[model samples]
Target: MISDTAEYALRAVVWLVQTPDESQTTRQIAEGTRTPLDYQSKVLQLLAKSGITKSQRGTGGGIRLNVSPDGLTVLDVINAVDPIQRIHSCPLGLKEHGTCLCPMHRGLNDAVKTVEAAFKNTLVADLLKTRSKSVPLGIDLPLRAPRKPKQATA
Candidate 1:
C-alpha cells in the first residue's frame, strides 16, 4: 500500500493533468486536491526532484507536470514519495537460508510483485479515463448523503 504522501502526490498530479497547460501554486493544488497545503508542498518538491514535475519560484511561479499523463504511471508518483520495496531475499537473514524462500515469505513476495506490476502498468491518464464519472479520483462528497437525526419519541 502507498503512504498518505503518495496519495497526495497522485491527487496533485491528477489535478495537474486535468489542467495540463496551466501551472498551479501549492495553495491552488492543495485546494483542488483537498490535501493539506503543507504536506502537499513537500510532496510537490519530491515530484519536482524526481523530474515528474517542474517548479518555479516568485510571482506567477508554480508547478506543472513535466511529462504527459499518458506516459506517466501511478508507480512514478508512488516511487517519488514512498517507493515500493520488493523483497528479493529472505527477510530473516538466516545464515542457512538458501536462495529459495519459505512458502509464506515467497507468497508474500509474489503478492508484492503482482501489486508492483499493476501499479507500474497503470498510467495516470488511464486512471483518469477509467475513474467513475461521478467520483473522479475517488473524491466526491456528494455521493454520500448526510445522516438524518431521529426525533425522540414522546
Candidate 2:
C-alpha cells in the first residue's frame, strides 16, 4: 500500500495538471487537494527536489509541474515523496533465508511490484480523464482566488 505522503503527492500532481497554465502556491495546492498545508509543503519540497515539480520565488512565483502531465506517471509523483520499497531479501535477516523470502513475504513483495508497475504505466493526464464523477481527492474547491479586475487608467 502507498503511504499517505504518496497519496497526497498524487493528489497534488493531479491538481496541478488540472491547472496546467498557472503556478500555484503551497497553500493553494493544499486547499485544492484537501491536504494539510504543512504536510503538503513538505511533499512539494520533495517533489521539487526530485525534479517532478519546480519552485520559484519573488512576485508571480510559486510551484509548478516541471514535467508534462502526459509524460508524468503516477509512480513519478509517488516516488518523489515516498518511494515504494521492494523486499528483495528476508526482512527478518534470517541467515538461512538469505535472498529467499518466505511465502507471506514473497506474496507481499509481489503485490508491491504489481502496484508499482501499474503506477508507472499510469500518466497524470489519464487520472484527470477518469470516467468517475469524483475528481481526484474529490476536490471541487477553486485552486486560485478570483482576480480583481483592472482599474481604468486616469
Candidate 3:
C-alpha cells in the first residue's frame, strides 16, 4: 500500500502543473488543494529531497516540478518517493534462484506488472488534464481556498 504522503506528493505535483504560478510555497500548495497544511508541507520536503520537486527557502521560496509534467511519468515519481519494487525480486526476499514467479506470488506478479505499466504510461500532464471529469485517487478536493482555521483553540 502506498503512503498518504506519497499520494499527496503526486497530487501536489499535478495541481502545480494544471495551473502553474511561478513556484508555490508549501502553504499555498496545500491551501489551494484543500490538503492538510502540515502533511502537505512534509510531502513537499520529501519530493524536494527526491529531486522530483525543487524547493527554495525564505522569501520567494517555494516548490516546483523539476521536470516538465508532460515528460514525467507517474512511475518516476512513485519510484522516486514510495517505490513499490514490482516484486520481481521475491515476496519472501529469496535469493535469485527462481525459474519464474513463485507459486505464492504467481498471480501477484501479473498484477504488479499491470500497475507498473499503468504508472509508466501515465504522465503528470496527461493526468492533470482529466481534472474536469474524474478526480484522481491521490487528490480529492477541487482547487479553491483552504478552509480557514478557527480563531480560538476552544
**TM agreement with the true structure for every prediction:** 0.83, 0.86, 0.73
What overall lDDT, based on C-alpha atoms, would model 1 receive against the true structure? 0.80
Q: TM-score of predicted model 3?
A: 0.73
| Residue-wise C-alpha lDDT for candidate 2, range 34-142, written one tens digit per residue | 8999999999999999988888898998988777777788998888898999999999999989998999899999999999999999987777666567766775533
- Which 10 consecutive residues of model 3 have the lowest summed lDDT? 141-150
Better of 2 and 3 by TM-score: 2
Error of 2 at 37 (Å): 0.7
TM-score of 2: 0.86
lDDT of 1 by residue, 25-123 (tens): 999999988989999999999999999888889886788788777778999889998898877777898756665788888888899899989999998
RMSD of 1: 14.3
Best by TM-score: 2
Model 3, 1-154: lDDT tens digits are 5677668877787777654446788887897767899998877877888877877788876777666776788888877767776556566666763546676687787787788899899987677566555676455433332222237765
User: Residue 37 deviation, candidate 3, in Å?
Assistant: 2.4
Please report, as a residue range, the 10-residue window in candidate 1 with the lowest summed lDDT: 140-149
Where in model 2 is the C-alpha error above 4 Å? 139-154
Q: Give lDDT for model 2.
A: 0.83
